[model samples]
Target: MGVGRILLNILVVLAAIAGGFYQLKLKPILVKFGQGRVIDPRGNTDCTTVPELKACEKLVLHQPSGVVYLACSTQESRPHWLPNAQRFNATGASRTDYVASYNPQSGKVTKLKTVNFNSPRGLSLHGMDVVASSSNPSELWVYLVNHREPLSGDPKVVGADSSVEVFKTTLGGSTMEYVRTVEDPLLLTPNDLTGTPDGKAFWVTNDYGVKTGLIRDLDLLGRATTSVVYCHETEGCKYAIQNMHGNNGIAQAPNGTFYVVNAIGGQLTVLEKQADNTLIITDVIESDRSMDNASIDSEGDVWVAGFPKALVLVYEHFANPTKVVSPSTAFRFSINTGPNSFYGQKFKVDRVCDRSSYTLSVACHRIT
Candidate 1:
């Protein structure tokens, strides 16, 4: 071989050897550190344990240590305390509220990751995304509890309107800013969202006193296509709510059963949407007062977020027809602290994370 040709061949061999070494050794080391080393936020090896947390705040298991423990608690109304977890955003402009976090095992949150918003009143989570449903994916599935219908003699805004705005989310999993709102000229405001596993129609709560909730199916463009009701009077539903109006929290089981929980009367009512176009409330659990948000657990138990009360209640799993109407008392809540017992339960907004005033830059925060 020529001198220059031999030199080129030698250079190629060295490059290949270097590349192989990086692929096998250096690359993995870089990845390990890049993922972040699990530094114990608290230095103590002795983990402070609890008999059983009041409301079961959050169960986070670290990978390195193989240690399983509940996520440390925070002051009320704080978001993003636990990094890398996403939550359902509430309405209005303040920022994020109604936050939830995942188990880190299946990447599904047993607890709501904190999110901020201008309005905290209208926010909840099903603990599910429902990406896939029956034959096809669902278009629009929404639920609103304690929903006050316009027919109850409430004044309607003529120029302005009331509707549920939904959108197809962006690449990063964050929802697109602009949403297509389905204007329910008949109803006032919606509270939550619900649908079956197999793609079908969605349900919306209308008049509280009358006990009629609206059900509608949307198209790909976010247009309301099919709209109707799954009610007791119409179909002679087996399990129904009559006296306690105002439905608030909404959830659904894997078996296509609709679970609607109302705040006014504090009741949880379940119904099955029939092929013959009807709704039957198979079970009813009354007196679930102050219940705000709900999520069906991996074991099919329903978890409700009782705000102000700051309580998390869990209803046991159910099979098919014969049902457990309402979970009288399921789970509870408390403020978790460190080894020193420095932190306690945060009952009020001011005790936890709150906004600052002095500077225009929004730099003030007191984690007391």
Candidate 2:
């Protein structure tokens, strides 16, 4: 072959190698990041955007009263100090983040006053749960993932000194009393939590094992270092399930089955609680978008809120939530008792609602 012909052959070889790399490596990463995927928007007609509620990262409902408790902060603040997203501008973080309740029946939103809880940093809210008191139906137990800045160190360096804060409130009362803060090393980077009715114990999902590092970012690209930590008031916090990839919000069903969201990978992990309070993974439900939080309703259907465009959510919406619109999609997962159940499709997934907003958590009021 001539010199020009040999050069042409070399160029062809390089092109083939690049094509293989794109298919085997880069494509999966892009898909995981929700890039270039055609979004078929569904269930957009029924969602009603409450202009009063903005920038709530988590929501839990008091089923008996049809009240939804929200872990909320101003949209202006989340861009600066959302630790899970690694935007650790502590000075810009909201000091007055609050828990509010929305009554579907009355269509009234109330910001539950924090009584006797005086942390200097106030509440930098994230994932939360509001469980009815087992002993008294009139009382409610609130479990919050508080992402307070580190006491003695820089938040950018150490990440948020996150903890599960337990509180109590009445059925229809406006005041919520602070009980105690459960802080431990095992609460590495708590993203979301599911609490017991008594409020003495809870299971929190640590979205990242290594705090404030490159490894934490690599977790998006399949690093299985995230975990679920089980914390008790007296026993402290311990890892119930470890080496999980992209663990985010956790919701427990009425039957005691737990559904954990994989924030990056777009999957739901079904976990069963053991006798020792540890969780065993029983099944996985796959999805196409990145999910943030999961909530189960009175009927035992699991509802998940996800980002249709992950890049827009992280880069644009979180930065300027008011102006830029990031589409949020809610998925409903229920046991497939239909004909598909015989084909081994155990769960039926439906896109119940989709709207343009920074939706981090979701709760279903009815099956429709």
Candidate 3:
């Protein structure tokens, strides 16, 4: 064979190999882009007319009066990857990190004037009171895994500590009052929390380990080493559930079953709290979408917020918040309370909210 022909053959082989690699590796990511296409909840093609719900997380439903409370953080803040970051380019902008209430009967949302904090993530209501995890930069540290130098001399390096802020409210009232703040080292990266029946204790989920930045992402994507800590009034905090893959939301059912959502693992871990205060995984419900925070209704129904296209939605939301609205779904399921085994089936999924605003939670308040 001629040398020219051999060279042409080798080039063609290399091109074919590159094409195969692109199809095998990069095609899936490309395909995921279309998966995040916003679906009109009103069954229409135009999404501009669709109602926009406030970006919220850690919803807690007060069953007595049918009031659903959620943590809404609508302000543009610094990037988690950047150390000692500040809110830039926002001249007259203000942070809307407060607790909001949804009235099912009137179909109205009322922003409560109670506890105001920066970057409130997880929330839970105990009777007439509520507790939320405030993950401000001062309370929560976002270490740059790639950058070794500390963020020294940065004036915006404030609130790098972590704490759980508590608030008091009425069962069906629209007003609230700031109570106390629980600061602890065990609450590192607290994602979600739920109060006990007596309101004397609570459990918060630490989604990641001490390692931040890229290493924490890899840990969440692989073997999750985080845990759920039980914070008691007199005993401080202790581990209740361990080895969770991005444990985001937690809710205790009326029957004492604990429903924990793993964001990275895309699974709902059903746990049972023993008499000794430890938790045992009873069942696990797998999901195609990445699950966030979850809430349990009085009737034992589970409501969860999930990202249909996790990669695309997350990327688009962080990249261009105005152009690409993150699409999310509210999933509802019922647990089959059997004698020995526990299982659940997803009964419904409502795509009524745009997660581009960063909707991180869902809850249902059933009126008796």
Best by TM-score: 2
Cα misplacement distance, residue 116 of candidate 3 (Å): 11
State in Å the error of residue 290, model 3.
0.7
Q: Over the stretch 74-96, how does candidate 3's per-residue lDDT look in tens digits?
A: 42431232221222222222233
Model 2: ten consecutive residues of lowest lDDT? 359-368
**Most accurate candidate by lDDT:** 2
Q: Sort the predicted structures by TM-score, highest score first.
A: 2, 3, 1
> lDDT of each structure?
0.32, 0.85, 0.56
- Cα lDDT tens digits for candidate 2, 135-173: 998899999999999988877888889888889999778
Candidate 3, position 65, lDDT: 60
Score every model by TM-score. Answer: 0.37, 0.92, 0.67
* lDDT (C-alpha) at residue 2 in model 2: 100
**Residue runs of model 1 more than 4 Å from their true location after superposition:** 1-130, 133-160, 169-180, 196-200, 207-244, 307-368
**Against the hidden true structure, what lDDT does model 1 obtain?**
0.32
- What TM-score does prediction 2 earn? 0.92
